[model samples]
Target: MKTIATASMGVTVALSLVGTAPAFAVGGSFHCDRPPIMEVMEQVDGSSALQSIVNQYLVRWEARNATEQCQAYADGRPYDISCMNGRRDWPAILASVPKDYFGRSNESLAAAVRDEKRKGNGLREAMAYCRSVGAIK
Candidate 1:
């Protein structure tokens, strides 16, 4: 009976793991559009670089409102969308998109990468700056 119980417990644990989403799936592709927000998180500062990128994207999206921002994400170019939490008064867009969408803008992320080099700091430092400015977390 003890052996049977242990086997059941193991099976339960395995099932739990299988039920959850894969970490990579949550992160999605590493395109400029879907930049990795975790890579730039500075826990000490309580800032978010990804949030900054989202804000910039909203600005441009509001101006165009034609999936232009999404296209920019696809094209892998520097584009601004910053506009107060990246919604630009369009809360519905924020609600409809996935939670990961906020941090996946290419323009701010590319800027972060370039800033990393210009400041002569490594990835961690650059990311910290991005977070401090509320760019990505």
Candidate 2:
């Protein structure tokens, strides 16, 4: 009878811990140090057209980061949940950009960035494309 009682207590404690673990999970109120892309762009030139494109790129970048973090959390990999939550603001920033600039989807933009990096121009080509879009400008 004593063994049974001890086993029951252990089970209860385990269940309690499982129930409350998420409440104590590491998440909420995190900030990113990533600087505004405009600050970086300003060093080159102050074209408002370029600024808008860079802003959209930043938004997509944040969204990508958030997606990776969320996937990490789901996979039981260590991740900063608070930072991921903060990155969730990407949707709002993305909405501010012209639809044409975004391509078919975020993946397309990611691919484009990757291609730009591969060419060794870094993101200059992408930014120039953004700035050169006469229709939007």
TM-score on alpha carbons, each prediction: 0.22, 0.34
**lDDT tens digits by residue: candidate 1, 9-117:** 3433342223122111111311233222222221112213333333333323332432343345345654343322222444543453336435444454556534432
Residue 95 error, candidate 1, Å: 4.0
Global lDDT of each candidate: 0.33, 0.38
Q: Which stretch of 10 consecutive residues in model 2 shows the poorest summed lDDT?
A: 15-24
**Global fold similarity of model 2 (TM-score):** 0.34
- The weakest ten consecutive residues by lDDT in model 1 span 22-31
Q: Model 2: residues >4 Å from true position, as ranges?
A: 1-26, 29-44, 82-137
How does candidate 1 fare on TM-score? 0.22
The local lDDT score (0 to 100) that residue 51 gets in candidate 1 is 36
